[model samples]
Target: MWWGHPLVAVLTVWTRSAWGFSNGRVGVACGDMGPQHGPRPRPDPPPYSLSVDKPSFSPGEPVTVSLQALNGSFFRGFLIEARDSEDLQSPAVGVFSLSAPQQSQLLQCRSAVSHRTGSRKTHIQAVWRSDRNPPHSVQFLVTVVQDYQVYWVRITGPLVVLRGATESPSTAPPASPSSPAVLSAPFSSEGCGLTKSCLREPEGCRPDSDHRCVFLSFTADASGRSVMFELSGPAEGYVSFALSLDKWMGNDDVFLCVKDGGGVSIRAGYVSGRTQPELHPQESLWGGAWRLENGLIQCRFHRNSVLPPSFSFNHSLFVFLACGGAHGGSVLKHQEQPVVSGRQTVISGPPEDLRGSRPPLLIRLHGVLMLTAWMWTASCGVLAARHCKHLWSSRSRPGHTLWFQLHRTLMVLALVLTAVGFTLPFLYRRGWISCQRRDCDHEAQAGCRTGFLLAGSMQDSYSERDTHLTGPHIYGLPARQHTHLELPLKFQDTTLPDEMLVKIQITFLVKLLENSSFVMPPLLCVCPVSFSSVRVCVGLRSDGDVTHTHRLHSE
Candidate 1:
């Protein structure tokens, strides 16, 4: 039906509209909803973008990367993911989120990444769902380039920094006639790259005249902590260096200190500097070169109550040239020369024994002199007594000529004997006593031929006998045999009557004899008798019989 007039011919025929038409389905009348429209769609948002302030960094540096969303309407929020080139598939890749209207987020790239040399890339992506067919992804690439900067300085061979003079390898060359010498390298107390000359040459280093003349000057913060100073160039021999504390402290403090290759201290100070009164011309200022392996010169300042602040002072080293050529020719020549004087005597015995033996000869001489003086006094007394008796008897005869002659002659003879005896000991005391070589002579007395006993007993005895004449041991005495002796003694009584005295004495004798058979012998024959505790007693009877008693008591 033709419905030209809107709504006028609608009742005439019912026809299906294109919108309602279905294949193989009954047609239905179309109702006109003219120009119908659903809710309008919003415009699609633009993709997100990422930017990094810096992607390349040196070791120990930090970099920051930021993510930005270009269009806000893409999604309610976006998830940002960052992955390193080697960790792209790792679930632990750095991920973060930014809500709509949020434009950027920051990620810190650590300096540890610099460990990997060469170029590396980090992929930064943002994912968001939009009204489009599927989720959209936007990515940016960050390239991390590793750049490493290192600085170091080394002294070659034996060349060291010169003190007082500014010329050095690290010192800048003089510009012209106007400029003073300056260090080529910057001076620093800490951190890397600070360098100075070595006081001694390193092993295998060539020893040119100029190189040997120079030495290293190292200054520390006065903490005395060991520091490493590198030496480069040709290595050779034991490098000997000296530390001059004179400038920092005083000349007295200047010591040649050396540490061995094994890091132990080998020697210090002047080797021949002794605290004696005499000065030797051979002794020079104590210093010289040591082996090269001992190139490291460590100087320790003595800690004291008046020490300066740790940062106040510094350590300095100096190089002492070899005496002559680099081959140690000077040392060899010095060793070949013979020693002429000032040789020290070596005393080897134990100190105490040496001291003890020094006085015996003197003491023996004095003892002999004392004996002679006593003998002289005794002879003079006898002569004086004899002269007095002669004077008393010859009062009428005026004087006895024979008596006077005899007295004078006797004194002269005594003096001669005394002088000889006194002088005899001096020979032995003065170390002059020596035995004479003897020929075999059977006609000589056997004892005389055997030589006289030079050492005799010097002790005194009550019997006026020489102790040397007694043998050290003797046998055949009672004490040496049965170690017993019987003594009988009787005491007469005058105060009491004979009858009473006899009765009392008998009673006492009976009591004493009761235990006589069991008593120990008074004369002890014990091989080792203790004289300290030996006691003996004798009981006497009126008839003059004696009983011996013995007792041993401890004090």
Candidate 2:
């Protein structure tokens, strides 16, 4: 009985390890394309075939590669790599990106890409690019995992000789245009919580057959080995979804379905903070397909129920959907706030309907506080100070006039509201977010208007922060342009007899430096130095030398 108990414990430990592999964390098998299924791969011929688009390519050129089940059946998992054709034992020479990033992921070394989940797939297409200094002849080597013990290892794939060299014997056929890479029809939402989990814009809008419906759904398979996801939305450049621990954007697993001309590019990425995502190889998805009909972009894909080890161990995550434009593969920020799930959810858990909202509560309050302060309180404070001084002429409170008290209270309240509103977004996002000159958020717009109030109230303090740049970036001054303004000192002019030559070239980095109306008039009075009096300050720890361009002119 004691021996039996020990054997059962050993079996339990083995089962747990195998369970993790079943979810497709197979970096351990990267050296040799083999599964740790406790059985040698069968010697029987595989029912699969590998295909490529062209026969040969130049160095660092992209080639389309496909793995197909010849018998028209589904394969559970697969690993494909590019290797030296002459030496099969060498490491993978090129890299691969998947057409679908849902059920697959790039390996640790990025030399190959494999299934991230055990979801069944029929055909797979990947873009493999050779390195700048690739092997003279490269061949793709594939290992298809049909079952725990029924997989085929080291299946020889197509070979490509170097460009300008003689062509080798062709092993794979050309890619077919009539492949299963395109969706046959539009998605339908006939079954919601009864069959799968659904999240749709406009509450109950159906995505089935309607191009206008913005919808997202996820369903775990009956065996719980994998989950399939569908996302349909209207976006000109890109539509994306993310799995996050909370409603915030940082530290999340994001997937993008970017519109690349005629077709779509599905990619996997990770968000470090509120910045552009770090995209993974195209080989990170499974059974991926996209449809661009009318203006809506629809995509379908699959992934494992168990998240990858590199991803967090937390299975419960909040879903986020966002849309944005990408310029030449660099994705921009979402046009607006993302639609987030109300509660945390485990994708593999029981099916349930989920609802979400676009803006956070903090954001709404921030907007209200900013609008009230700027449009109402601030305006009233200025009116009381400038116009109502005579109306409340009597010193009602013994020392302070009623208008003075009112103006002070209103101004103080406006400043407090502005500061609190500005701080709210920082609290919500937990950090600063980068934005373009034109694409700033509401918080930024409000902060810009209110920032001047605080800076003007506080006396200018000589504070210096660290600077990394040592170029023309510090002052955005033109290299050759030297237009100057005049400040009067004692008249000792060299050219003009009665005029004093004090070339006032104010350099204000933080302020919006427009010499005309939009510029802050108060900042100009902080320190007016004659360009001739401006000595070069080059501290050892400072960014660099501050050049006095108007040194050429003198009195």
Candidate 3:
């Protein structure tokens, strides 16, 4: 009875309308395995394979596209474009070109799709070209879905890892369906610490001193799918959770708006560089569900959205917790921390991976050796300057001065050290970079070294890209000094809690010396220092700048 004329025609019309299929094409009805249907014809296989590194992505995030030659022939180059639709009239979000390839290659691209465009689809098409063969093209599709998981990553600087606990990826909370992951970390801001009392200072987070010291703890549900963060402090007014993905200051930024017991549903939005995050309800895919209980501000977000946009999983992510106005007028106070530094705050990974996380040991040794040589040379220069009169004195000499012989001997030693140190880093890198099993797996190791060389090659380009910054930044150039001679620490090869911070200070000192009126060669004037032993002597010039300074230290 149901297989009659009117019923069959009605069902056919409904099916065609639902699936948007043309009447001329044969279509298979649901649950109809009849003989007339035969078997659905298989479409032709693709000429090549296209894939991306991540499971999914958010707008503005960079993605790595991998192209593999499937047939007998390999592609030489490619012209790739990303579009929202197949319509010929639809404009592409961006276009890129790949240089000559070696069978397979991974390329990077930044998605320009707007988050406000609800459930829009993206299509990426690559047309491969070669000199001796015909051009081949391939297409791939990506779906945009709502991100329900929120990742609550913790960032601690080198200063916090005072204890010698190995902070590797293997230590990460294992997946468990039964229990929530509880993390309790204590961060103290003393009476006059950076964020509270010095709020108006250049390095401070905000200009308000009303901020009080605070401690925070978090509980993430199984599998890191959900998180509940509780903040305990004098955090009155608006609370803000800012996620920094790209650079420390400006890049792809996501912000969460905090209010009452359950203020408007948790909200988050993205901003590039210094622009304010575009926070609007209609366009955001982040659910932003949060609540405040027992004087603690509790917030949750899609965890997967917190991961880096590209291939870097261990990238150091900066999360800033601050107090601002309810409407996001300006921040009052905040604490910023680095979650994963390849050296100090290690977020568990395989042992080999952890080793690879560090720049090759030889390279670090090379840095120390070169620094030692440069520091020795500069120390000799300063000593010679300070005791020139004593060196040429008709009578014997002063007790402190090594009578210039010590300085000359140091100069010779520095020269020798410089040569050896300069040659050490290159010893392992044959004519080109070589991969070693002790360091990492072949692919990742190769990629790391390649990325380093590439970044070094494009340092100027990178700096230029960062110069046009847009956000609220307080850092500024140092005040001009009339005369300055900076003495850096000597023998800096050691594992200590505050060593990196000291090195940073020394670097700043070196930079100031370079900018001073006394033009000493900056690169050759490096020094290192050892903790627990040191001596410093300063000589001032007529222009009120320290013309000569010496720091003696022993480990």
State candidate 3's TM-score.
0.27
lDDT per residue (tens digit) for residues 407-443 in model 3: 4456557656766665564564433443333433433
All-Cα superposition RMSD per candidate? 42.1, 19.2, 25.7
CA shift at 119, candidate 1, in angstroms? 80
Q: Give the per-residue lDDT digits (tens) of candidate 1, residues 462-514.
A: 11111111233212222221233332222222223323433443344333333
Worst 10 residues of 1 by lDDT: 347-356
| lDDT (0 to 1) per candidate | 0.26, 0.67, 0.34
Q: What lDDT tens digits, residue by residue, belong to model 2 across residues 186-205?
A: 88887888898888776788
Q: What's the true lDDT of residue 255 in model 1?
A: 24
Worst 10 residues of 3 by lDDT: 151-160
TM-score (all chains, Cα) for each model: 0.14, 0.50, 0.27
The segments of candidate 2 whose C-alpha lies over 4 angstroms from its true place after superposition are 1-180, 209-212, 274-276, 279-284, 310-314, 327-330, 383-398, 435-446, 457-521, 524-555
Ranked by lDDT, the better of candidates 1 and 3 is: 3
